[model samples]
Target: MFYWILKYLVVGPVLKAIFRPWIVGAKNVPKTGAAILASNHLSVMDSIFLPLMIERPMSFLAKSEYFTGKGPKGWATKWFMKGTGQIPIDRSGGSASEAALNTALQVIGRGDLLGIYPEGTRSPDGRLYKGRTGIARMALVAKVPVIPVVMVDTDTMLPIGSSRPRLVRVGMVLGEPLDFSRYEGFEDDRFVLRSVTDEIMVALQRMGGQAYVDDYASKFRKQAEESGAAPTSAFS
Candidate 1:
């Protein structure tokens, strides 16, 4: 109910009317079934804007801090994330990751689109960083296609720490879905996981027209932010 109200009555009309985001290969998104809308991270608005454009009730995994915040701000924040179907993911360590993976698998188990940022964090620079193997493991475990996505030019609207957002052209491209059926049985193998992850990055490179990096999001954080604020993230 909140999602619709925000979509139709508030943010949706304002975003669509102002940004006029161009969506390419939108049909690439499946009408049903479990699939991952994997993409490169670019801006803070990536989370809110991507969900607004998709036709289905897609959900995303957000950092746990958003839910466990302090003060009246924290309470309001938690309520909003819950109302919109965003799950808090613990990104601390192995145990946390496992828990997050289980949560993600559960969502996939129910046949829904899972929005994930392959880069883990938005690029401090615009370059596409190496994708995490979590996306690959999810694909293999869930046995679903991973649709590569690229969001262009959102850093301008809501760059980090800026109280006001700029009105500019934004774009999201949904590329052809990637399938790894040939290596179905080796989904748990680490090397196979890396191989599949690299494959996803390659597709993102094609769509983003940026050089690819084979490191974690932290490695690129400083570079991605030399200009202030990364230009990427999860669809929701």
Candidate 2:
């Protein structure tokens, strides 16, 4: 379908030829069944390059704004995101978080791979940020394994606010699948959720080699905005 055509025929080949992305531990991804690919979000291209390198088609819970933009560039962005197998979910918290969790569960319910950025948003700096507990909840509820993925140097290729990507090699590392079956029946426990989320973030930091930041990335970005500090790009 559109995903196949875009991944293999249209956009995939072009990206492969240009960026020449290298991957390690791709065999860690399960060949079948439901699993969550939790990654550290460094740049927007983290979504694109990870899915491109993996064999199985993965779906990401992308923000709804990507699907509702106006004008030609917006149209192209919307088309590309859809064509690449991204599902739009409102990131606004409260009931919206529940809806997104349900949508993510539905993806795994179909025995498909669901990509999630546990950090919730792209890192304002190159350091790994605290992960949101939603991913932990989803994994516990879905009763599936969670694999830690790390996208290398993606921010350098396409930093925030950059309109075009640089021609550079990027890489991905997939860690072994993490089993949280011990806490299977405790999905509703907030303490357990935080513990699970912290465990996953530790794995990512270990694999990705990024300095760990205990605070949330979104909070850091918001604080910077409120203090009149200009957002700093990864390259900057």
Best prediction by lDDT = 2
lDDT of 1 by residue, 65-88 (tens): 778878887887787777666888
Instruction: List, residue by residue over 1-236, the lDDT tens digit for candidate 2.
Output: 99999999999999999889999999999999999999998888988999999999999999998888889878998999999999999999999999999999999999999999998988876789999999999999999999999999998887765767888799999999999999989999999999999999999999978999898999987787577664554222
lDDT of each: 0.82, 0.92
> Would you estimate the TM-scores of all the predictions?
0.89, 0.96
What does the lDDT come to for candidate 2? 0.92
Please give the RMSD to the true structure for each candidate, in Å. Answer: 3.4, 2.1
Model 1 accuracy (lDDT, Cα): 0.82
- The TM-score that candidate 1 achieves is 0.89
Please identify model 1 stretches exceeding 4 Å from their true place: 222-236
